[model samples]
Target: MKVKIYPIVRTAAVAVLLSGVSACSKMYDVKPQNVVEAKNTYQNIYDADAAVTGVYGKFLGLAGQYEVLNELRADLMDVTPNAGADLQQINTHNVLPGNAYADPTPFYSVILNCNDVMKNLTIMHNTQKLTDADYNQRWSDIGALRCWLYFQLGLQYGNIPYVTESFSDVNTVKDQSKYPRIALADLVKTLIAFMEALPYKDPYPAANSLITTIDTYPSKMFYVNKNCLLGDLYLWNNDYHKAAIAYKNVMETSTPNGPGDSYNYYNTYTLNSGSDNDAVTQSAWLTFFSRSMQDREYQTEWIWSMVFDKAFAPENPFINLFANSGGKYLVKPSQTAIDNWSAQRQTDGTPYDYRGINTTYKMVNGQPVIMKFLYNYVNASTGIPSDPLAKNGRWYIYRTPTLHLRFAEAANRDGQTKIAWALVNAGIKGAYDDTTIPDPTQRRITNLPFPYDFDARKLDAPTIRGKYHRNLGVRARVNVTNLDVSLQQNANFLAMEDNIINEDALELAYEGNRWQDLMRVALRRNDPSFLADKVYNKLLKDGNPAAATVRAKLMDPKNWFLPFN
Candidate 1:
């Protein structure tokens, strides 16, 4: 649980972090370094240039923490015998204050680093060391990261100490009188306000962008997906209309080729004539988590990914947590998760979700292991990774499937249930041609009003085609059977919402999102059982000894979060 700092960090960024990652939450509240060091560090464009990248260095330390906190606590994963007490506590929902994984220190380390960079960047701008364009780009990029980290903190820890200033000393963070803890809702509103007010909402321009040498790993992969983060904030705030607009903006983002580029990934993989026949060849669905971010589809699909290379000194933390060999193998896919994936049929008339059976988790010597992190790392002939010393891969932050799922969630809550249901099982094209809605005009996707607007008016021309006409729904992409919307018999919003949540698990399990997905729905419904029941069921299915106690504790809602101190 004690993840190391990224060894591949920029020199200036490392200098910033030498001070600490324990800062106040507000921007410019305090200078992270003393006046002399601040003057020395923020003197020029080079120092200014390294500031944002430095925060990312600290950010990389959070690789496995996200997966451990998010999935292990949720219903999708279970701890193996090798799992330490910290992981065991997390699994059974009996985490104590001293639990290493429960410590909020690493998270604060990234936040403090963000605050450090933001504070210096502002000073450099005011002093004319950086131009308006340069300052705005760096400032907003770091700000978006801060917003995302804070939102995640709130999601995991609930009412947390929300500090925004740069803390010169680590002990300064304990002074709650100076920087008070706020409710998660308040934090959401604050983040929403902060992000919406930023001048630049898009990816950094060519000159200011964080460019990677490898083409498949796009510049976009290096930074936070600001719009997706905004969409999440709005969704959690229950402003589904605003959330839909935010998500729609991401879906409608133009290609790198000057806004006219045809491919702006909107769940656009085709359902071919041989779609159901994964019986003969490899599945494209599994490529979403491949070793290299090497393909064009990967370019659009990976909204945000934190990559690591052992040769470069940055390494994949999840390899130890999820892998069977050359790993601690502390975690495995839960029986409940396996059962859920097994219940669905792939397009090939197969009995399981292709992403589930062999792709996500596979048996090695008859033991089920999470293969997602180790898939391409392992050799075809042998079951172990090629370079076993230190692993290299990426941790998924947000992706296209998550984008569509979230978009569907927002649309559903905004009273667009049919659209939401379709997004789960079929594409928007299928949503439009819904069997229940007879009229073409009323059901047509092109005519849908603003907030629910996704233009599929022109299917022939690639430029004009819109919102999933080229796309299939989340489940449809994997060729699963259609989700039962119960549109005719019971047309329930919450039920359809439940369907979306269930789809979220089936599509996105072990990607560091399960707990948040389930928790968000449970909170919205004001029903603890919405989350507790599923968690209890997972424990029951796994035959956990503390199932009853865990269920009782989770029913209180307060017990859902970890001990942050």
Candidate 2:
């Protein structure tokens, strides 16, 4: 068996795992564990690859927080009676520094590992221990992962300690003079610079198993897509045009065929419901979130995924958090969220969104547990194995739908409201017909740019129709009616942006991005009421008496972030 290469990270990093981590200047300074000597580390390619895997192991530890911090604090999720006081505080937007989820140690631990991995990988390349190709791919993967972690930290805490170098002494990081705290905006700038400069912005080549297969799972889902992440960083940085370019890059993937090519990884869950394959259509949507990374069709829809297996690591925490039966059921979909899903129209001309009931979350034992994570876990017909399996499954940190939604957000802000609206309701083709835009001048303005115009059916007679027409709108994929864009001639981007945010809730809710979506939009408009009203309305639905106070607190931008102690 190959050696399990633990990262030779800083003493402070390992200490955080032992004794908790705090967000204050004073950090955990205990003697480091798992300290491997330099001579024993990164001796070859496999060794360096193992070190990156170790970083992912640390990332997996933070997977549960991706849901808790992002979802629990927002309107789509609510704490149940069984939830701890800490969870309650987060839901109410009154997070205490002492709240367990508020601690920054896990994030820093992963960041420190990423720092050490990059430092060692550089050393390996310099010493001729690795090929230039191997060096670039590994180095860029670790760099992107670090950038993603920092981005998440910045979003959650507002201002965070931006440390990029790897060190041994805990005091080195504690010395705020050298490594000062930077706001989310500055961090985004640094991250964009670092990622944009990486030589290999793509995933590891086929020969490199690090980017391909990890046991039964694809490591591509494990590593963050550099462009997808850059797109998100640009979004948070509020550079809409650049953000649109970044997301567009992910869709095209620098390929010859463009976004229409089936080879694209940013493909969404296509809904092709028909009499001949109604169940098959539902199953296609079902496997979109599973341990079935082996499924090529579903794999296209996943940009980044976290693997959890009962046989490999401990059982995933999601079952305990989201499953109603054989689970703690700490939190569930909020009543308002349920109502939103109920509000959508399914393709079968049904009243409710097919994704909402029995798909996203299901009624089991009289409780509505979040089913996205624990999908197919119950022995219901949806079970993947067709038998009871452990609750362990994959958690999507980023996926296809998320990329499209974010792209629409940036595009709308960049003055492509019709194109953005199309991405949400009718898709690139459906939203751009002569009737959709009507006037030739308006059509020209609403026309999708190169990659986004996958279908490319224009007024030109030759290029307007073909088999290359696969870009289904988010709502259209679910059998919902196309949005009425006829009345939107005078609509500003902000109003369209609000509609996009609503689409975000309908399309990508409970995937650990709901809160950030609400916060980002609110911050962009400088309208506290945009965000406050949503959470306040959620509280009123749940009958939480703190609704008024929570809404009042969120009216200030300061309360949008969690406390650091």
Question: How does candidate 1 score on lDDT?
Answer: 0.72
**Residue 220's C-alpha lDDT in candidate 1?**
46
lDDT of each: 0.72, 0.70
TM-score of each prediction:
0.88, 0.86
Model 1 lDDT per residue over 1-565, tens place = 1121222333433332222222112222334442335566677666665566556755776777878999999999999989999999999988887898887777877777777778778888898988898888889989999898888889888888877776655445556787678888898999999999997788776544354333244444678878889999999999999998988887766533234434433332222112322222335667667745645556656777766655443357777887777888899999999999899886667787877877888887678888776765665334577778756677778777788889888988887887777667766676575447664443437366776665443333334444545556677767788866474123488777878888888888888889999889999989999899988999999999899889999999888877666
Q: What is the lDDT of residue 365 in candidate 2?
A: 70
Give the C-alpha miss distance for residue 448 in model 2, angstroms: 5.5
* Model 1: lowest-lDDT 10 consecutive positions: 19-28
Name the best candidate (by lDDT).
Answer: 1
Which regions of candidate 2 fall more than 4 Å away from where they truly are?
1-35, 168-178, 212-214, 254-280, 347-349, 381-389, 435-452, 456-468, 487-490
Residue 74 of model 2 has an lDDT of 84
Q: Write the per-residue lDDT of candidate 2 for residues 85-123, one digit (tens) a residue.
A: 889988998776678888877787677767877888888
Give me the runs in candidate 1 sitting further than 4 Å from their true place: 1-36, 214-217, 255-261, 264-282, 347-349, 380-382, 434-444, 457-467, 488-490
TM-score of 1: 0.88
